[model samples]
Target: MAAAVASLYRRVLPSPPAVDFASPEGKRLFAEALAAGTMEGFFPLVSCFQTQSEPAFCGLASLAVVLNALSIDPGRRWKGPWRWFDESMLDCCEPLDKVKAEGITFGKVACLARCSGANVQSFRANLATIDDLRRHLVRCVSSQDCHLIASYHRQAFKQTGTGHFSPIGGYHAGQDMALILDVARFKYPPHWVPLRLLWDAMNMTDDSTGLLRGFMLISRKTAAPSSLYTVSCRDENWKSMAKYCVEDLPNLLKGDNLDNVQTLLSRLIESLPAEAEALIKWVVEVRRKEEGDPSLSKEEKERLFLKENVLQQVRDTRLFAIVHDLQYANNPCCNCSSSSEEDSLTRIAAAVCCQGAAMLSGNLASRHGFCCKETCLKCIQANGDGLKTVISASVVSEGNEHGVDMLLPMSSPGASSCNSNLKNNVVKYPSSADVLTVLLLALHPSTWLGIKDEKLKAELQTLVSTDNLPDDLKREIMHLRRQLYYLKTCKEKEEYEDDDLPSPKWLG
Candidate 1:
């Protein structure tokens, strides 16, 4: 049985035009390219070459090699005492089991890369010229700083398979050839194909996306991936959550007292999976206090520092206070005007803008906030109770630079779709910043301020005092206090600047 199985493995797929790297002609071409100094990508790619875990995982395998070669930290533990990229961990966009069975497409591959924190430039063959592709191929193969992945029809090279993905290991400018570092090492060796031929292969349409197959230029992001939160790249579930935030959540806030709003906040927090809730709490309460031991190695210290810096940025956003302001915007006694539904919607829009922007680390307000605001106002006016389902918001931009879209399904007011059922499938967790947002809002001064109930105010004050609060919560509150003070001073300075009087140096 062993002999027969080995015999089956020995058979090579029918690839005609491609020259196997081990063959004499292929070796000659490679040596010539090396001597000509065109093999820049070869060394890095060869060092990180990987075999696909499954036949349909060529994209995943190719991506892992580039990610590792770029030295990007995976953020999550790959094994004890280490973090690395592997095929199994590339499920930020699609499930591993699904990718193992059905393979992945160019867009999804790009989505995964974006979520994983790479700076990716994707080009569809139909939209790009052959000359344009040649320029990219030459630039990638001549540099170790970036890498390229070719998504092409395997049969275009006379291979037996259909769609496939592999990294371009080198480019021979004089000969106009590209060295393909095939990920499916079980069937094929690294092969050389003419650059134009590779272009022809990529120009074919992908049935899954109904777009031409393409190539992606991937490199390490200037900033590392966030250690605190990640976007759920799943389309439908993200939409449902966004719709909930834009429509349902604000509706729940209307005319409700602090007690009811607190209950609602708890309900939303409870909606998260146990794993997600635990992760958020651990990051907030535990990780914040972890000033890594100076006794550890330099690399460990750098990782710890990166984690601390990102978390500090989250803290600096004062997201919790913003969320608190939104929740209390509709209070009967608050200064917010809601005499007309239009006014109410406008306030909701502003709150949503602040909440979404804060959750997104301000990217949403600059890029997509106006669109979301306009959509909400129009939907409320045109539809009322029949408000259309929002396809997405900035939930996916939590730690993402490109702000990938995540979709969610909308249910009726009482029938929420944002629940733990989304765990490990469509969503990861609510943004840690969002969880912190609600957590901090609970301690906001407005929650207890102007209250007639002396007993309730005293109880809340007691809960917020340093003696009653946990160390981590206390630190967070202090951070919020400092941040709010800074904002107040800045606003005052701006007001003074607007007048004829010189701005105060003390404020500065």
Candidate 2:
């Protein structure tokens, strides 16, 4: 009876002891790292810092290093529905004993990084060979585009330690070694380790997942907008589109087009000769310099800016020239020119940028023409007849000349049950940034490319396959695909063809 009662109530395990903080050797090592420019440089991490007051937190400590490196502002844009993930809510900083007891996992850590907008990718290390490990370092850490979080067993590497997490700052290829920026400063100093040893360490099985401990790469996510947004071809909207497209051009050119203009121009921005980068920056300064000068009247200032800042030299680069040429080669751009010289330069920049986006996304870019700004592909389809007329005429059309109203009701007869069932319960996206892309993909059956039944599952499978793609994105695509599939099926059953369908407001 006594043994049975004891078995019914488990004993609370004691927390692990903390690492020594004030050791003289630890301070010296930290100072050396500071001198080597290892920390994020925003703030100093003292010798005594540990992620948790009690128990092991090498993972949390390592995470702090990466987040700090990314210049993450813990207070801004990070507090939302996912605020539960904030440092304040974390067991390390918060008094959440239960959470501390539960600990963190590779999956949880990866999710947090994604939520923080880091393009994070993880690979299993159990099967990684020594050469495979070298390749990972060369492609990730050595490239400088990513900071790696290494999960490995210290004992496996012959270190008097257990499982540990840390970042690798760089690689010494000639030496066949890596610079380990260990976050557990008190336990282990930052140092160089041979590739073979590191590989063996990574191959250690993780206690939590029953999988080999490996590494994750975190960097800024691809900042380009998808191919769905396009430059408007309509006369009224073209000017505004041109002006707005300048800042967005770099990304637009780099979107998902098969031609991939970025293949040729991706590195052009950074690869520019110093003189060219200076010249690009100077172009904007030319106008600003005039704006600040006291001697020049407003009119003279404008003249100087136009003459000096808007230089043919700046525009003559191989990059801008190709972009500008592509814009002109495009048809229907004949006389939609801007009246103001300032507006002209702005529009030129916009055209160049739009062309760049077209290159990146493999989508056709419009130069001076109007593009339909409808929210959904169905809306675009509803205006297909008008779109053809306007596009073919090679001229700007105004104000729904083809009567661009929604052709399908928000709730169709066949889809009403499905739509109603999932309406309020639809999965929410972590960010609204990629809605246009998902909406476009959900348009029609042929576009589905044979993904008919279980369309939502198919869409999710496609999204989940993307490296470092967030779970929220997969959920969003699933919800949108569900709505779209139902809508398409319902529309097919309707007797009326395109024009006879419901009006544009149905998209609401």
Best model number under TM-score? 1
List ranges where model 1 is wrong by over 4 Å: 1-7, 10-15, 233-239, 245-318, 321-508
CA lDDT, every model vs. true structure: 0.55, 0.38
> Model 2 residue 478 lDDT?
36
lDDT for position 80 in model 2: 16
Candidate 2 regions exceeding 4 Å error are 1-54, 72-99, 223-508
lDDT of 1 by residue, 49-148 (tens): 8998789999999999999888887765443334678786786567666787899877767667766767677787766888988898878877888899
* Residue range 56-75, candidate 2, lDDT tens digits: 55666666667656544332
The TM-score values for the models, in the order shown, are 0.57, 0.35
Error of 1 at 338 (Å): 40
Which pairs of residues clash in candidate 1, taking residues 3 or more apart in a chain or in different chains? 235-407, 236-407, 236-408, 237-407, 237-408, 238-407, 238-408, 239-407, 239-408, 240-408
Candidate 1 RMSD to the real structure = 19.8
